[model samples]
Target: MDIGVALRDLGQVDSTALIERVLGFDEQAWVENSYRQKQYDVHTLTESVVMIFTDGKGWPNIEVSKESGWDLLADVAMPLMHKIIERHYPPGGTIIRAMAAKLLVGGVIKPHVDAHPSFHVGHRIHIPITTNSRVRFMIDGKPNRLAVGNAYEINNQKQHSVMNKGKEDRITFIFDYVPPEQLQRMQQMQQASQ
Candidate 1:
């Protein structure tokens, strides 16, 4: 499929209401995790560095629990997300997950692939809430800065990473989308191939 078609702008979502939902909202209600994997550039595992909204199982250093990250999800991000998913993502597809991440002054997610070995399909999308020149999404080994008013679709199977060289914090909205066809293919591949 055309991965480029996968990335589309859903207009400006960084509205006042959205900002309020993020800043004023309670992070305690949602599930989150703290990650200190060396691959992600964890200089000090002791310090609270990362937070995520995953199922909370795989990684070793999980800082915030996914249960607590639920409160971190914002309402304004939904409409823009829906517009993109409804148009491109396959039927029966759901935004299976989301993450509200913080990249501090020195925080960095080292070069890696977003796709797991389990599934060689689907799409990885990102919405930058706050970013700067230092923060980047390296797709296919090429680095890209998150521009305001732009949404990005990344080929997670390719090597990627993020770097926050600036002093201010960088936050982004991230999630996964599965095409029905790809999901069915995965099931079939699992049943027959296995």
Candidate 2:
């Protein structure tokens, strides 16, 4: 259960299309509906997330017992996303949830653990599309910055939080997947090679 604190880099991908797509959206397109943590009543931290693929209910609802389906907006952006997913995740794994999360300038996600079964049973992968050095992601109280275009595997079962102190919004594509045993073996091989 101790997955270590190092950020596992899954290499980089061309995030041009993804960044363009996100930047093209209207200002009102970002929806503020996240159940991960409660916004502070005194100092509200505005954030938003769009579900591209999910358990079929909708955004903000992480618990689902049904098959995953794409949202209408996701259908339109599936081509690029599919390419990214296929290149990284490939097939044979169960991807329970996928979304594009946006943290506005000066926003913060209070520290909390994603204790849901869905989060505990899978690995959370993050592909930062647009980010800056000021955007900090804290996992178990350690702050880390995910640079744009790089893919990283995060241990979401641990206590984590995000803060956007940059002047621009921080956007990232996140996916939850139950990785196949083969993938684990491959990672072990990689570690041995190192």
Cα lDDT of model 1 overall?
0.53
Once model 2 is optimally superposed onto the true structure by TM-score, how far is the C-alpha of residue 51 displaced, in angstroms?
3.1
| Candidate 2 ranges with C-alpha deviation above 4 Å | 1-3, 32-46, 52-90, 180-194
Give the per-residue lDDT of model 2 (tens digit) for 98-176: 6666777898877867654445556677878788889888888788878887778887767778888899988887776
Cα lDDT tens digits, model 1, 29-128, are: 2213444343334322212212223332332221223334454453465666676777656567545455545566767667655534322454666666
Q: Rate the local accuracy (lDDT) of all candidates.
A: 0.53, 0.62
Q: Rate residue 133 of model 1 by lDDT.
A: 76
Model 1, runs deviating above 4 Å:
1-16, 25-32, 35-66, 190-194
Q: Give per-model TM-scores.
A: 0.69, 0.69
Judge candidate 2 at residue 187 and give its lDDT: 50
